[model samples]
Target: MADISLLYPKGKEVSTMTLTEESINDLSVDYIVESLTKDIYEKNSIKKILTNLTCDIDVINYRADVFEDILNFPELRDGLVELLKKLEDLRELEKFNKDGDASSLWQLINRLREIDGYVLCITMLKNILNTIPIKSQGLLDLKQTIEDIYNNGGFDILKKDIDETMAKAQNLKSVTIGVNLDSVLKPKNAGVISLNNFEITNSGILKNFMGFTGSKEELNSDEKVLSSHKLHPANPSLTRMKFGSAQQGANTNVHIDTSGSATGDDPLSQSLKKVVTDILKRMVKSIKATLQKYVNISGYSLVGLMPEIIFYIRFAELVDKMKEKNLPVCKPLAVPDDRVAYGEDIYNIKLAIKRTKGEEFDIIGNDITFDDEQRIYVMTGPNRGGKTTFTQAVGHCFLLAQAGIYVPATKFNYSPVDNIYTHFPADENDTVDLGRLGEESKRLSDIFKVATDKSLLLLNESLATTNVAEGVFIAKDVIKAMAYLGVRSVFNTHMHELAHHLDEYNSDDSYRSKVQSLVTGMKDGHRSFKCEIAPPQGVSYAKDIAEKYGVTYDQIKKNIDNR
Candidate 1:
């Protein structure tokens, strides 16, 4: 359980099923994730959330609201990011407590420190939220919880007790020792002594030993006890006592012991160890008593939200980056029940990422309007004319829009799709198992079995690996299925004949959305990469390629004359 969930709405269980890898690859989803999560902290965790993206309308709307709040109020996002940075690993605490492993006093102290950090984080965030405005419903709930916890009388009392206990623990800075030893360098007894502001200096001892030869008025006070022998007359004087030195001659080895603390943690005498242990025992008991009441609070549960916080912050950063470049990004309006999707000035987001990485290029955005009239599009264009790029762009727009982040478009509005099905070209290895055409047909069949009228299908150069006659024959049937199924689709292909026969499929009245031909255009005999609602210009495409390579009749004649 998380203290705050930025991804999900309160009390809503996110569905488990997600778009398949085939669909993700067809839409270039992995590329999108990589681009968004770049330069983000805990990037792996962020990627996990992105990889498991949901297509649920409510979930998407929930995320969109949270992202909107973050984008609107940057200070709040920054504060939350900073607060999340202080959270220690909660799993470690759970594991330690689960095993009841308090074998050492240091472990107990560390646990207490972690708890103290959590309390401080919560209190500081509560105070900071007072100045920052939060609009998201989920965040408002979290804020209310924090306020309630802080205003409760029991919480204030517990906090005060913790502060006082820590102050006492901090005051126990140094320990004094009293040791009793036998004649054989063995300890018999030891105890902690009250430590004063004891100073070891030369002049103080000398002044006490040889009283100052000053005026009689200065010496009239009580005489100081100069020697230990005088102070303890009954005990024998051991002022000149000398112990055996560990130093050996020139050939002797003097290995330095580099381990243990300077405070005699690994003392050579057992009596000294006993004294340190006694102090630690007392300190641990006091700390345990202070923390006992707060142990079950599960404050570490807050750390579980660190990764989610990073996810939102990182995407917000990318949104800012897109804004800095003067690119168009808009908040999408989701109409889940409408069963229609459309966007104006929609551009390929993957291209935007490349351009941001210093790739020099210009982008021309295309507008799409899919409704009951034109529900499926048979897109055809010349090679390298951005047919696949444009198709993938539509899918990317939907994914980004529903994720609640700013999409790379000027305007976007769409109904949420229940799922996305893709029929891109198969991998080379897939052909080994079932030849290219067989595999493509099988995958298409699989998609139809799962896809519904509310699904989105993106097909890129599908069914073109076989001969033209065979390809067109199979593509015609596929287009018929799309029309009858009434799903939104972009079937970009080299088979211009298939795109030319859209009227044959649209004549059927039972079809929910009419099929239309969408061609990638040419301007001034150059590839424009601009998609338009028109018939495929196959003859024009061939002529442009011939003239570009000096293969036209006039160009060939001129080349021969020059030679």
Candidate 2:
């Protein structure tokens, strides 16, 4: 079991990062993950998988293949879901054995019920294995292993022991309790002195008065009479009580007792309780001896199936939702490590979420490419002009691609990054202790310290918390560092001046990455939200805003005349 993992390859160490809640929120990764897993899984558990995005391509592709196979076979997915639900209860069953407490008769009954659950789980798996046509090696291996276990003698032993034990457990019909009383009629002692006939639960006067002499073939399936030894108890607390004398049965003992008040608890009742407890202990010991081996081996393997089941169920649900909504989700081609990172028809997934929520707004998709000539983009645009949206979209696409899911784009190709680190602006409340600018600078420095050339950086208004002069000065150094490190990045900002030194940064032969300017376009006084490779538009955005608002001198005069 130690060598098994649904997410990781056998013998390969699982490597992942512990992203902070702030970082997760900053990138909207939580939003995307929750949206996909909504109504399918609890938010907290689903968020864990989203935060721990794998940097390993092999593991990512492996899970993707497994997800595809699940999506292809609806019956397989449904079967696995039912099995996983039953398997989820196994955790509670496992806890009973973790502590060495003695089992009560009542507790033993509950264990029998859980054992029934285990029996059902095995039968369900056997049926599923026989039905689903699994293609992925991960699922195929699981199927083969389950088949082997089913045919093993251990499985037969488990079935036989469960049947026999359950039969024995069920055969207790009724108990007759006898209590000794004092002068005040208080019970001084109590014991089960006799076992009675099985109680009839159903009440029908005609049936009680008359006996049916029907042929076996004429009786209904449920109408079969219980044999003497096969009689079952109505409840867990009731057990067969053996009496020493048949002469004790009389109406005289049913009269009220005039016994005196008892000074202490009944010793007879205490003795009887111990007797029942000891009997329960022996029964548990026998059952454990018969079933422990199969439980030890099969229980663990089933537990290990939990994560694999969750992964398939969540992804398959999202895939179905996307198909129903006609959203575009395409498989990405993972480019080699040394190749360029690029995506076409790239759109922000956040917009897709809005559309799913019944928003009628149109979502515009853009394209981005990161190659030797333009590895770092200094994106500048007016506020609300889609700079932040486009920057986050690029990061989301890469993260989706690496996770081996369909990207939001129609086509995407990416060199896998070691990790993604985001530096979206901190909230005023978050920066209050350190002051806004100070906190921003500290986060930027931390990002630089850990980031590598193979990492993808998503910077959204990072240094804009400070004054223009200071921000531009610091932004230049950060851009220079990014270029020197040769990492792929999108630094979207309101600092239009940051785009001025592109030629200077590109001229440095020591710098490994080229710098380029990107701007969100404005057409006919309306924000187009289309990002492209071009120089900054500068004050033209303010002029466009004025014209659109009718605040320009000529537009204002025309508005006044029309009014």
The candidate that wins on lDDT is 1
Q: For residue 363, what is the lDDT in candidate 1?
A: 85
Cα lDDT tens digits for candidate 1, 156-215: 777787678666655544444433334642333444444323322323322432353345
Against the true structure, candidate 2 reaches a TM-score of 0.79
- The TM-score values for the models, in the order shown, are 0.78, 0.79
Displacement of the residue 26 alpha carbon in candidate 1, Å:
3.3
Q: Candidate 2, residue 245: CA error in Å?
A: 32
Candidate 1 least-lDDT 10 residues = 247-256
The reply for model 2, stretches above 4 Å from the true place, is 36-41, 95-119, 170-275, 292-295, 298-300, 557-563
**Cα misplacement distance, residue 32 of candidate 2 (Å):** 3.2
lDDT of 1: 0.70
**Candidate 1, residue 375: CA error in Å?**
1.9
Model 1 stretches with alpha carbons more than 4 Å out: 1-3, 38-41, 88-107, 167-279, 558-563
| Index of the highest-TM-score prediction | 2
